[model samples]
Target chain A: MSTPFLKKDKTGICLKLHTALYGHDAIEQFRGAYGDGLTFVRRGAYWILSFADALEEDVVDSLDSLLVLSRNRKK
Target chain B: MKKFIKADGWVKVPVQTKAYPLQAIYSAGYVFMDKAYLYLDLEAKDKVVVWLKPKAKADLDKLAMEFCQELLNYAHYFSSLKVNAESTKLLLQRALFSAAPSMVKEAEEKEIQDLIKELEQEEEKENRKPVKKGKK
Candidate 1:
């Protein structure tokens, strides 16, 4: 809600999060929750989430926030 | 304040492993897990690197200082725990064993009664069996 994720202000197309930071469990949690419409690719230490369709900036931010929430819940 | 490496949207805080143990670092990292995105890596055999990326715009210097302080706090805690571990374990064992004797006695009594009943039933069955007539 504070601001958009750093992706040139167009963060809906694709998303990248360092796996070491948020962890693989977080991505799996995201996949179980919001991954039906997204493509997931694990490239080394990063998880790249490609959207299936064009989404609003706020929606993208919400998904990112969800990813963070999943990370917290993973503990 | 130690020199916090300035970077784009993130700061690198490095600590010497010789100064603080890995457990201390991990404990500090856990405290900051919800507050920031932490990526811990070993730069060398003796250097621990922590990359702290805040969710919002904040002072990187302050974050780094806080992390260091947390690490120190945990290190002290662990040391104190180690110092008192023997007495703590002894006290906990005494607390648990204080109630265990009665519980164990009751369980053993029940088991012995069940065994005695089974033996009595088997003996009764044997007594009730008709003795086969043997050649005189």
Candidate 2:
């Protein structure tokens, strides 16, 4: 599935995932998975995922899995 | 050769892409994050222009030198990491071995013994060095 909020730039792609409420916990998870290629920046109430160009597919897949799991857990 | 030009208060340093890749340049830029505001531009297919604007009142020449130094430091850092990648992986694996609960006790014991033996040998080599006597 495509990430609707994902935006492309010269450096890489960015996803608007609002995980700021969870603090650094959620950020740490993505960092552990993506290593140095990915960074998370807090913009207002939302967290933005800035990822490298090479790992665009991996980032999208991981985000999809994360979203699905989170939804399943909630149910 | 690296080229440097001073324009106003900003120093523009030209770095070859072959000598230092974008990743290394970016790493060096990150190191100067608190000290200067950095702007990177592609001068050519093989050249990158780094514009450094000092945050405080500092010598432009010195800032240029420091930026070049930072670039070399990052270049060496990345090259060394590439060289030691295999050894680093081995070190990490050894470190994580103890965390694996399913690992065999006998194998862990042997690994510990081998590490102790290596440490003992290193200590012995250190002790074998002659002490220098001070002149009276």
Candidate 3:
């Protein structure tokens, strides 16, 4: 079965990111950049970013870099 | 700590915060950012589940082992940072503190120059003022 963090359904694959870890600002920045290709929704503590197709490694790395940048700035 | 499980496409590593703090986990993940696609989940209050998918097709066992080593590297690095934090801060401050007097001196010299210029301008103005001629 698909996990809460990663899901695959009829629509496509969606990744849920926790705001507490990555923070809201970074997620918003990621959304701003990827909003055209992705759908971002807030269910609760997590922001679920959905993609129509399976995400490539670069896309995932982009998010990872954003989160790390945010975390580093906060520190 | 040696436990590394290989799933269909991802390698799952369950880390305990007691052994590997969250900060260390983030640090470790950062180092592996170029190597893998990472997904983090909360397994428990103190346990973090790290899911890794290698960017290239490679040995899962070796990849998992490297990740664990990366975790240990960061864990020690962070703890050492904590231990040296005060001294590091003080050393940095001391270095800046030593350099500050020269900066302060430069500012003081500029201020003195400005004051001298103001005084000279005032003197010039005083000299330029027409003196009232007294009846001889």
Task: Rank all candidate structures by their TM-score, best first, as comma-separated numbers.
Answer: 3, 1, 2
- B30-97 per-residue lDDT for model 1 (tens digits): 77766666655556668867777776777888988988899999899988999999999988867776
Highest DockQ scorer: 3
TM-score of chain A of each: 0.65, 0.64, 0.69
Candidate 2 residues A1-75, lDDT tens each?
Answer: 233345777657876654422234545665676677777777765577777755545554554334322223321
Give the lDDT of residue B21 in candidate 3: 86
Question: Residue by residue across A1-75, what tens digits does model 1's lDDT show?
Answer: 222233422334556665655568866777777756667778876677766554544443444354444446544
Query: What TM-score does candidate 3 get on C-alpha atoms?
Result: 0.70
Residue-by-residue lDDT tens digits, candidate 2, B73-99: 989988999999999998887777667
What's the lDDT for all of these models?
A: 0.69, 0.66, 0.76
Query: Which candidate number has the best lDDT?
Result: 3
Clashing pairs in 1: none
Q: Any runs in candidate 3 off by more than 4 Å, and if so which?
A: A1-5, A53-63, A66-70, A73-75, B1-3, B97-136
Using all chains and alpha carbons, the TM-scores for the candidates as numbered come to 0.51, 0.47, 0.70
* Comparing 1 and 2 on TM-score, the stronger one: 1
Report how closely model 3 matches the true complex, as a DockQ value: 0.20
Second chain TM-score for model 1: 0.69
